[model samples]
Target: MNVSIIVPVYNEAKTVERVLMELVAVASNDWEIIVVDDGSTDGTRSILQTVCQEIGVAVVFRDHNGGKTAAVKDGLELACGRWVIFQDADLEYDPRDIHRLLAHAETGHRVVYGKRRGSWHRPNRWVFALGVLGVDLSILLLFGRFVRDHATCYKLIPRSVLTSLQLRSVGFEGCVEITAKLMRSGIPISQIPIGYTPRAMSDGKKLTPAYGFRALGAALRWRNWRPCPSPAEHTGSSSTLPAKRANSALN
Candidate 1:
């Protein structure tokens, strides 16, 4: 397989199916979509069951809600792509931008982050904006690399590079942990602009200033870590279906 998209969902019944449909429209037959239901108590699990069965996207139903990072790690185990990217169930991010980030990976960049477009709709997001700026500055202060959005959900990484990392974060700090580890290992993120549509707390937006603080702490913790096993080429995997055999929804 070429690209593997891992979608970690939790209580996103309203938007999960629509996001999957968007992914189907953009992803090629050779790409794999692995949806991990982070033990959602809502109707999301049922919807994913029906949607994945119909469209043939791989789905993993966790027995309990183990947070987003847990679901992400579970999806990674079954991923079989040369390159892997993440898609949030929330429509804040545009699925059509997947290939734009993939374009950088195609040209041999292993790590690509999707920079969200400015919010013209919400002018009062200074607090949210400040939290993100704190994350970017923390990385810059420690690694001498200015990463605009460490909390962005749209990082495209090679499966080989990802699996090689000693990923240990189990919550909202996942993105920050990955970025810090990569930078410590001498890898830098390549940024690509992508569309974004902000959602409110009433609309199930989960990020908070507390999460940002936790992520900043994570970024500080991994500054000096070294990788024993550097990134190597991944051979292949049996988890992915053949391109010719992929269902019409994915083709």
Candidate 2:
């Protein structure tokens, strides 16, 4: 099946090129790579444009920064493929795992999250772990889904499943919201073990402990608050969208 990889980036000038090169090297099947620039103030946008032009990849440049969630949502809407997967601009996650994800795409699983297995000595590891634990328990209690990893960006989702998702959060909370919504909708999900290289805060990694708390809270609230259809609902019926609601703090 054709694959559509949506990579939402912000100020990733240092690692974007290598990530793109890895994708080109490992991804042999028919695929479309969509790089969404989330209002990057640095030369990230220019670099993305140049790389996409050279690699013949698709590009979606947003004028204003809407955070990772908004950028990813936009890219998914424009994607035309049987399978869609999310990739981070940083090379933390390996591109070679794409094939492992696709191998399970035909098994009726709607979403596949790359579960990172590593020792906890990294910075903010405790807070992120606790937040993930809280969020996971909340999901089980509210949605009856037990996901090993709740906020993983390396998620492979079928186009049909992506269409059914109704998301609006523009931050890390987006990942929690999507997980909760998909599980609530009775979509099958799987967690696969993958390699992860944690980056330090000084390395331009923006997901901080504050964002982790915000994400955990969002997961809990999203379990109860039903999301409305986004404006992109009319684009296709395969998406099976919900109604839109203003960006709620809890959502």
Candidate 3:
């Protein structure tokens, strides 16, 4: 397989099907879709079952709510592609941007990020600006590089490099953890501008100021950590079971 699209979903019933359809439309046959439902209770699970089955995508249903990091880790464990893209199921980020990110990968870039363009709907612009500044400053202090969107959900990482990291975050902090590890390992990260449509808290947007603080803490905690040795190349076969059978395996 060429690419493994790992979508970590929570209560995204409103947008999950549309996001999956967009992914399916943009991705080629060699690409595999792995949707990890993090114990969604808003009928998102039922929607995923139908959509994933219709598209022949692999869906892993968690018994209880684990955070985004845990859902991503589960999908990574089952990925059989050489590269993996973390795509959010909330539809904030566009799936078409994957093509733009892949353009850099084709030129030997192992890590690529989709930088958000245009203004976002923020409750307080100053607070959002400060949060972005905090994350960028934290990354600069830890890795000596400034990453504009440290908490972006559209990071495309090589499966080899991704599996090598000692990832331990269980929430939004995973973004910082991954960035710190990649930068410390001397991986060149490229970025491209992408479209973004931010959702308000009332629209099921989960990020908060508390999550930003946690991300900053995670960056500090992992600054001095060394990268683990890369594991032997994964040779596992991809699962072809229907969504129902896949959920059964999760149990």
Residues 1-251 of candidate 1: C-alpha lDDT, one tens digit per residue: 88889999999999999999999999887789988888789899888878987887888777898878888998888788888888899998988888889887778776999988768557446777788888889889988888888888999988888888868887888988888888877877899888889887778877876877797788878888788776568745646342222332232
The 10 consecutive residues of candidate 1 with the worst lDDT sum are 242-251
Q: lDDT of model 3 at residue 180?
A: 90
Error of 1 at 76 (Å): 0.2
Tens digit of lDDT per residue, candidate 3, span 2-72? 78999999999999999999999999877888899999999998888777877778889988988999999
**Runs off by more than 4 Å, candidate 3:** 231-251
C-alpha RMSD (angstroms) for model 2:
7.1
As a TM-score, model 1 comes out at 0.92
Report how far off residue 101 is in candidate 1 (Å).
Answer: 1.0
- Write model 2 residue lDDT over 105-176, tens digit each, in one string: 557665788888766788777777787777777778778769877777788877766766767688888888
Backbone clashes under 3 angstroms, per model: 0, 7, 0
Candidate 3, residue 63: CA error in Å? 1.1
The top-ranked prediction according to lDDT is 3
lDDT of 1: 0.83
